[model samples]
Target: MVGASIANFTEIRGYIKGRAVLGKSATEIFKDVVDIYGKGWMSYRTVCRWAKKFASGRVSIENDTKTGRKVSISTKLAEARIQELLLEDARYTVRELAKLTGVSSSTVHFILKKQLKVRKITARWIPHLLTVEQKRSRVQCARKILKMAQKIEKNNFPDLVMGDETWIYFENYEPHRKISNKVWATKAAKRPCIAKRTMSVRKMLYAIFFTARGLAIQVPVPKGRGITGKFYRDVVLKKLDKYFGKIQPKSGMRHIKLLHDNAPVHKAAIVTDFLSGKHVTVLQHPPYSPDLSRCDFFLFPRLKKILAGRKYSKRPSVGSAIYQCLISIPTKDYIRAFQMWLKRLKI
Candidate 1:
């Protein structure tokens, strides 16, 4: 977080500020500083920048060192610094200005934004333009549910794992391509035939249910879309046998929190029975909130990134690639994504 200065900057800084306060443009300042400092001390860009900050009031008059060289400042300089910063990159942080202009963070922040009438950086939460009743109801519902979820989320159990499944595509391996309007040899890009492999061979479906710790088994879903009671029981539940089988059945044995969406397959009586029998409590995510699903928003994207350029022709095949990719993604990203999910609880 902390490191020493990349350059010996005081003298050069004062030189730039002096010129900047003299009502000079960055280019003009750059030329003057180079002429005086002779390129041995500071780069044109760096010096020009310090001048701009000083003129804009980002570098305060207080910074004028009385010893070797002194940079003069005026009221116009402070105002100029403010205008320059806003007209340039308004998003430039005070910390960034401090580093660039060799001024204190507080000085830059106060001068550029607070003192000089620059815009404040806030969330800018605009109203939804909703009907009065609808907006009121939405706010009320958000507050009510947030209150309940907050209690459970903060206190009910620290060991919670929300689960969701996502599809990983093999086309991510395909090189970027472009089509020409002029002509082409043939349409090798024709859609896949329905007559082949009953619509499953184009890409195999894998179900991933993961959390902060790790994921359960990921396997090929023969029927990805139509996973019913029978299919869910035999294929999906059977693969996750470790979750219930000899993996510790009692509470607090592990950080065992099962989160799933409102999908019928997930809510099926049989599926509920399997989860409950294992003592894995289900956290119900709000409808249409796949963004809240950790697997969907976080793990699956990482899996895709890892397998971005890889193809099924490799030794272990697509299935193997996905399994490793699942675990290979840094845990830090996963935890960060979890925190993001937690943030959505209020919204």
Candidate 2:
């Protein structure tokens, strides 16, 4: 075999030109070159093109340089530019950044990801945009909860009952339809279609209370009636009180420590007076801080996920489904949720 060091484009093209002058066909010339050099030394089409070029009185064997835009390589300047662009507007896409920075999309992506060590992510939705005072209040409340949790015995954690109110829709559409409805299919098979359905306007306001043990009570407000301070105090708290009496007959509602969000109805004078009179200690909860609530973070999200993509014709059916979903949750999950709540408070 010919050594690679002795093999050059000029030398190979000259050999092809000489063979063409000797009346040798392109195919015969290519096979002779392969036998001398190697199997992949030159392709038959390349030999044929060179033979035609020699016949047309072409002398130079060197390849001509083509003219176009030079490929952009990742550099420190490009990385810095991408970082600056991201700082100016994080929403800038790879294509937009490429156009702005005078680089290809792949180059911009490489600099952003590999050099800058950054990744794009969707923004998380929070309950509210809190003011300075609200932020400070949340910190204070979190610290207080952390201290309380440290003092409480592990067994007595069940005494801390967390409750909240949310509207349960009769038909809850999946948040991500494309992902949830995805199915396995062959490449030739047509994609399946699903009819788009919006969230139902028909919903019932439900106040749910639970502890580390399990669900205590879930009260659905009557149709055409909204939650008022009087209703919450008389109806919601009354049922909770009854449940407590049935479970802890000796201690009644005295040992209960309620943790609920700071809705106007919950903070009303009537509700405050009722709780104070009943000796049910309401834990301190900062306004607009749903992240700290177990119901918001754990229970409601899981419940909604299970109920998503299901349609109910009647309100009673929805209520029954919710009941089943709630009870069906394993007891270990409730315990883990409470543990997570304490961990979050510490954070």
Candidate 3:
């Protein structure tokens, strides 16, 4: 066995020689070495090979001369080629970039980070693409709501009823894994896979309504019944009545401000008239703006994170888990979300 001092000193010298030095953590350095080399090389296998050479007092642990690897990617022409490859496919992995450019992964990375100054990030999933008019409408609607919230200032804040529907699957989908952006790390080595049942007919539509104070109610929408205007008027109305019987005007707030997305059922004429009769004011919501929706941005993710990896065989068990998770959220969180909603309107 070699001494720790000798191993450390040799590793430093090796780094300078190849311009890609890796230390022994068995994991990070192994990844670093793999990034410098292409994916054709084994991470641990190569690390162990270098360790053996270092033990025998070899000065350079890298397989080849630095000049040989650097020549392909260091020139102005090579930089242009690398940029063209990236422009064609922004999602290309570092290993893929190296393979396509016919250069070492470290070289591809150098041209990308040091030269290009561009980093790859995951794009957020949106419901649908918004048009220029839809974006203008969103900003206009936000302004109207902000004015409404302020105009009625006597009540500390009006009672805001925000509701949304989401399907709760019996088997949770594994979260999208992130690709490693390390100089040498590959996606194949870093992705996580959890064992879960793939097929299950069991699922439920959960309709949740909340106020800044806390959850008003979490209703399980009747099985086999799609959310229609009739359902909102008859079924959803009854549920709301159970909690807030006969909407009454409070100090400075003569009506409860209801906020919901632009779903077909919610926009139906019958539903609008029904809410009007009940004196529940529907706040203007921009189409496809889940970022503006409190439930979409906050409640759903919080509940789903707690439910991740939790297996439930029956409806009651799933309901219980959801209830516990929702109630456990601090009241301050809801207040903060409301504050943020107001802030987003100005932007």
Q: Write the per-residue lDDT of candidate 1 for residues 24-141, one digit (tens) a residue.
A: 7888877776776567666666666577678778765335455643334733464466567657877777677666566677666656654575665775654344577755654564
- Which prediction has the highest TM-score against the true structure? 2
Q: How good is model 3 by TM-score? A: 0.61
Model 3, 1-347: lDDT tens per residue?
45764665455446433432333544555566566654534446655565556545666553465553343325556678878987897888999988876777887788888778888899997679999999999989987887776754334344777889987877665542233222464767764455553445577888888777777778777767778888877777668756765344232223778888899988999988878877778899998788889898888878887776677888887888888989999987877778778878888
How accurate locally, in lDDT, is each candidate?
Answer: 0.61, 0.84, 0.72
Regions of candidate 1 where Cα sits further than 4 Å from its true position: 1-158, 174-201, 223-226, 244-255, 313-316
Better of 2 and 3 by TM-score: 2
State every prediction's TM-score relative to the real structure. Answer: 0.47, 0.69, 0.61
TM-score of structure candidate 2: 0.69
Best by lDDT: 2
Residue-wise lDDT of candidate 2 within 140-242, one digit each (tens)? 9888777777555467485788999988888777463357678899999998876564544788889998877788899999999999999999999999999
Q: Report the poorest 10 consecutive residues by lDDT, candidate 2.
A: 1-10
Query: What's the candidate order when arranged by decreasing TM-score?
Result: 2, 3, 1
Candidate 3 wrongly placed segments (more than 4 Å)? 1-116, 119-127, 151-156, 170-199, 246-254, 309-313
